[model samples]
Target: MNTLSYGLLSLLSFAPLSGYDLTQKIKPLWQAGHSQIYPLLASMEQQGYISYKLIEQTDKPDKKEYTITEAGLAQLRQWVEMPAEHPVLRDELHFKLYSLWLSEPQKAKELLYQRMEFCQSELDRYNEMLGGNETLREERGESHEPKATTFGRYMLIRKRIMDMESSLQFCKYALEELEI
Candidate 1:
């Protein structure tokens, strides 16, 4: 249930996107790396969560466009309505924290500072993207001006980014407190 496959299924609920398009959209927000996304897509298909059809384009090679099945839709609905779980921090971060004891305190502090800077940059990018950028809508082939539906989704993403930023800030403070 922790697999990002749920997010992929939810994205397909909006529209059938190619795996490439899905990866592109997800990269800026979620941690759906290309390596993770394609394999998950294959697994979802195998498990009957989704299905894809080859879309033949006049100007391009055929693409696999993914669509959610009824079962997938049911699962998505259940997932969305489920109460939120406590966030599971990434294992990499935990590993880095553990490694702090092995490094010079100043070096550990520098590492945390670097992480904080990265988080800030990510937050800025998320904010920019959510700031009524018409380009994304256009890229999605949306003809109308961005609507409430799109904006609402963007807001949800923005909230998640903000949460991550807050967590990063907290980590930064904790690192400083540790004098590391």
Candidate 2:
């Protein structure tokens, strides 16, 4: 299955959601736009992974409330148990670092510092969300179907926090190594 299929399945496994809702939910985690999601949703439905209901709305356009099917759940289980596809590690920042010998030390230092800010910003956002999740668990006692569905995301966000922390540390070391 494609990335979009997995994403849509992951969302629908939790609860029925409209296309707009799916787009909003994935904004911070992935870079999908509406143009990509709608088409993929149609394709997944064709593959017997998902189905939807048209909800009547007087205030706005009708919505497709999508849900996962038995096949989708099976697919999701297989996806979880199967080894991950080789992860991609492409980043423009790495290219910039590789080209550092041709750039001025002061300029490189500035760029590295900018990266520090960027990583920290992402770290801070995730930290805030982690805290919020804790509060939610305390207040509402997160359980049932939603908990089962969203657990992967909770693990994902925590892993990303480690990534950001490591990135920030790399920036600091790179700057000091440059002696700038």
* The best candidate in terms of TM-score: 2
The top-ranked prediction according to lDDT is: 2
Residue-level lDDT of model 2, residues 10-36, one tens digit each, is 888878899999999888767899999
lDDT of 1 at 92: 79
Clashing pairs in 2: none
- Tens digit per residue, CA lDDT, model 1, 1-180: 454888898789888999999998776547868888989999889989899999999998889999999999998889988897787666576787777679887787787787788888877777777666775555434453445446546656668687768869777686868863
- Each model's TM-score, in the order given? 0.67, 0.85
Tell me how far the alpha carbon of residue 68 in candidate 1 is from the true structure, in angstroms, after superposition: 3.0
Residue 74, model 2, lDDT: 96
